[model samples]
Target: MSDLTFVLAGPVRHGVRLHAQALGRRTRGAPLVNIEDGALPPGPVHLHFTDRIFGRDALDAAERLAALVGTRPLSVTLHDLPQPSDGASFERRRQGYARVVAGARGVQVSSEHERGLLEQVWGACGDGAMPPVAVVPLPVDRPTRWGPPAGAQGSTDGAVVVLGFVYPGKGHAETLAAMASLSTGVPLVAVGAPSDGHEDLLTELEDEAAAQGRSFVCTGYVTDEDLERWTARAAIPVSAHTHISASGSINRWISAARRPIVTPGAYVGELHRRAPWAVTVAADLPAAIGAALHDPTSTWIREAEWDGAALPDTGTAAAMQLAAIEAIGLA
Candidate 1:
């Protein structure tokens, strides 16, 4: 049996590394490759890649890394695809995929939406039209139960927390207004840099925080440990995202703490159905946030924290898929 070698191409911080180690232990015996140094292995059965950025450096890196792999069965596991943006880097990325398919057997995308993006890639590559997508859910590893921290726990003065990267499409500005309307002294945390927002936007958020004297922790780029700490401590972990497909970390925190979330218009209904207590509202509208926050206990937030099970280790998903690949007796 040939062992699988998984690659982590870019700046995958400590938590991801720890998860990879855990996945490696769970993988029976396959070696998981950490390509943080941008080095390629000799040759593995398949080449797996994960990415979430659309920045030039990230796109260029993906192109170069794809070259190093030199045509193995490729999987471009993208967390989010740029659909609303003007910069069609997706087309450029498709060209890279074309280079892969000229020698590689096939390519796999992470989600159905992402699969659509891949089809666009193929079309841009002048590969004619592609077919339907085959999507597999990432994972639902969230703990069934959760409690407060070891040190202390208490209710907020009515602060609603936003717990992911701060991108323009993630509904930062919209949430700011909604929070402003709410009576609670709620604050928004712009965790990571999600998308391209005008510089003035950050300045606006600063002004809002300054005006209210509320606590809005704009920790630009936090370590994984800090990410977990912040997510776990918040009273309400809201995600007013409108750009991305799915938020694994946001979902994980919800599952962990049954935390109330005011999701964007896209995910509002689905989130309400799955976890009714977790509020999902239109992130573009401040009224939505105000409405959800109004009923603090409206089947939205109960009691939970992100218990480290937001996204299943894609390494595990890869292992499962790789086994199926082997079952067919093909390399």
Candidate 2:
């Protein structure tokens, strides 16, 4: 095992933090240090980083990461890296992320798509060479028998479900608009609450759904049991992220033995190429939703017991990350 200490930052429920925790669990005796403790442990450090997890904004997060890097060997697995989709903050966030990359001994991104984004945004470091970057795809848990089979007793007919935290670009609005055009009066349900600052978007969605004579249901936050139930019942599980570096939500659907309808993008395209049966890519949300509702069986895998062998699991990802960290040559 490498001598790298894994640094955990961000809220407990945050995706980056949860990923770090998952990796830490698989790393056995490797030290897991909380960044909030005000001091990082000595020696090489590994961090699962996103700007918002470290500070109020990208620039501030970069400064914080720089302070933490003082004299120690550091490597990072970047999440939610800035892209052209960031609009006004793209340049500023790119500069901040560049600073983080410059100070790192190595870098890890979850997908080749994201690595391409990193190369586009950050390019070469000051030495005219990019940091050692590795691609470690996000973990997908093995499919298990979670609840009753789909469309049993508790299923919601024709419901279009969007799982995970709702935010402005999370595709809730797009789903809402799509559902409005549909003749099916089924509700568009969000299985989780809105992201911290986007609460107003939920209200707007509700009002818009009402005005359009469609139903929209935000379950706020539900227990894991309830989430599985919702997933099992969803007629059409959809993931329509407008800006995504990597998506744990899509994997969540896969893990539940559900094939989610996703919007096309580099990451989604890569995922579809790898596991075509796991997701359906749709260029038009409304048309896709309509087609899916017309024949709900199109969103399911044929295998009775899927092992999720097509994608990396948490253990495999942790091992891949450890190998990458070891290649960085921590002293």
Candidate 3:
């Protein structure tokens, strides 16, 4: 049995909380504790850290985490880590995340790309020895039902689906522009709601889609079943994020057996390297989408690969986390 306690903080639907729940299920004997609830069990605690989940801003989140952990040994899996792409808030977030990393007994990240981002922002530890950092690639869930719906083969009648919360730089505007450029006429669908403070962006998107004589729909906050259906029906699934350390959306598409057209980036390249069959990387997203629309089957993962041994799941992630915690002497 493990001695670690997994701390759950954030909205129920948030990615961090969802990941925590998935990890907790696979991590035997580790109690999942709600951080909102007053006391916690005795022992080292593991938190899936992200500034948005913990507080209003980066500095506030760091301070709140320090207070919550108090004297307990803390190991964190950092998410939404600071990078030069953050523009105006880069330094502030870098400062706050540095403090968080400095205080942790050990740290975990989802990908090598993210680890590089952290090292760039935080630099080497005081003595020049690198902090204990573990790289656990984010797990891809196996869908309850794999592959697209029957008769979906080579069909361009379906909408172009973009999964996850809508926000600035999340690929929505780029996707819209691409669709407009292609004049594909295929509706652009956001399979999730807008992120907080970005609701206006949806209105703008709808107006743009209308002006371009293309259809657009925001299926805000869909159920898992609905998401699967959307993926199954999508003519083209895209992950064109301009600023990403790690992308859950790409993994989510993989889980659904849909190989999305992903924009090239360090993290995307890493994922592509690991599972070349999972995504189609393209620099010109519009051309990629147009090609995908012409041959929809190009976006569907073959049955053999979906059932193959190459795919990693939450269980694999949990085992890696357990091993990492033990190596850090926290388990």
lDDT of each: 0.52, 0.84, 0.85
Question: Which residue ranges in model 3 land beyond 4 Å of their true spot?
Answer: 124-130, 143-146, 151-154, 307-309
**TM-score of predicted model 2?**
0.93
Candidate 2 local Cα displacement, residue 91, angstroms = 1.1
Model 1, span 42-109: residue lDDT tens: 54534444333323643564566566666454433333444435265655555544544443444444
TM-score of each model, paired residue for residue: 0.72, 0.93, 0.95
Sorted by TM-score, highest first, which candidate order results? 3, 2, 1
lDDT ranking, high to low: 3, 2, 1
Instruction: List, in order, the clash count of every candidate structure.
Output: 8, 0, 0
Which scores higher on TM-score, 2 or 3?
Answer: 3
List the lowest-lDDT window of 10 residues for candidate 1: 302-311
- Residues 86-170 of candidate 2 have per-residue lDDT tens digits of 8898887888888888889999999999999889876632346789999999998776664438455323356789988988789
Q: Tell me, what's the RMSD of every candidate?
A: 4.9, 2.2, 1.9
The list of candidate 2 runs beyond 4 A from truth reads: 124-127, 146-156, 304-309
Error of 1 at 266 (Å): 5.5
Q: What C-alpha lDDT, on a 0 to 100 scale, does residue 219 get in candidate 3? A: 90
Greater lDDT among 2 and 3 belongs to: 3
Error of 3 at 230 (Å): 1.1
